[model samples]
Target: MTYHHTQYLEDGSIASTLADLARAHRILELEGHGDMSMGHLSYRDPFGRGLWLKRGNLALSEVVDDDFILIDFDGNVLEGTGLRHIEWPLHAEILRARPDVNFVGHSHSHFATVLASSTEELLPYNNHGIWFAYEGVPRFADTCHIITTVPLGVDAAKTLGNAQALFLANHGIAFVGSTVAEVTLTGIFLEKAARFQVDLKSSGFTPILPDPEEAKEKFDRIYPPKAQHNFWTFFNRRLDRVEALQGIGISQISLPSAV
Candidate 1:
């Protein structure tokens, strides 16, 4: 398939967006979500159907504005240098399939990988875990090999369906969202929730779970526009504080009211 070598102009919104993407890497590292250079995050390019993702094999903390690459649905590197992630197809096919999703994050987070290796699925044992309780997060029950092929990416996207996240069987986690904040927050909290469940189950006791109906209710109220705004602002402030000490700038960018 043919792909365009798009130019990324660091203009108003694009500049702000790239800065947030850089800060997201730092936040993920601070949360212990980096597994060597295997993890990646991507957002749909505002200019086209292409995606902007960090270069391959770069530690999350090492990611910068120049590290971002533009690639198409065919996994062709249309812009920037350095290697692209081996699993770029995971982002490509998903974006092609789901118009609602603009941000995608894939990680081999410790707790998330551990939980995926088990037969048991993540249970909503508490408020933080409740968001995943409804459909119980989809599982891509296929091979654990890197999704390097378009067919593999398509299969993964099929498994994701309408869910917000996918637990790659015996691998890791892939999450989707309409905004960077939503995906980042979900990815972090998903790992935390998995860790909590695994620890609780290891105690050899039954953990009480919230009712599905009530859990969905709470999720609706807590994961809306207002809540995302508040959470994103709070985390961005933390990022700003860290960057300030190093003489870097990360302007606070707000999520759109609709996302």
Candidate 2:
């Protein structure tokens, strides 16, 4: 079946969302989760159509509105020009499998990768980590080969079933969300949680794991949908001030609320 972003292109929401996504990538880079150049963030088409992803040539920090390309579930590049990420299937398959998910983030971020390679469980040592307690995160234990093939992506998606995030063994972390803000915030927090967990372990001190019940209560109170919009606004403001964004046009784009 032919797929296109015609609906999103006309509505203009896609343009705004693409800018936000590029900003999210830059934010991840500034936070040091970019892993040199192997990180990506994508959004499902507004009409539940295709996926919008960054071209492989641009660094996460340098992504702009024009850097995004549209693709179908089979990884075929439907629009735009340039190299598609070899891991495109990872996003495509997961979006295909999870109708609830609208955003996907992947990064060989330092802390998360280190934690994933270890035998230690990602314990809930803090509020940031406690959020994962609502639904335990899964680890994709398959081979760490580049997920260039459709089958490989499908395997990764199977491992990620119904969970918000998944750690690829010896690889990195992939996060999914029902909206851009949720996924972006979760990605940021998850990276923070990894840092906290690793730091405590390295110090040889026993960390206090948050009670699941209390954690749930705290999560509900602190991270309702509205909180995501607040976060998006805060982060977008930060992006606006970054020196590297001078020519990126993100500041000029009137980004719609990410809720």
Query: Of the candidates shown, which would achieve the greatest lDDT relative to the real structure?
Result: 2
**Model 2 over residues 32-55: C-alpha lDDT tens digits?**
566555789899988756899888
Model 2 CA deviation exceeding 4 Å by range? 1-12, 244-259
Q: lDDT score, residue 168, model 2?
A: 83
Q: Candidate 2: lDDT over CA atoms?
A: 0.77
Instruction: State the lDDT of candidate 1 residue by residue for 54-96, as single tens digits.
Output: 8986877667767788898777888889898888999988998
Top-TM-score structure, candidate number: 2
Clash totals for all candidate models: 0, 0
Task: Give me candidate 2's TM-score against the actual structure.
Answer: 0.87
The TM-score, computed over Cα atoms with residue i paired to residue i, of candidate 1 is 0.86
Q: Number of clashing pairs, model 1? A: 0
Compute the lDDT of residue 232 as modeled in candidate 1. 65
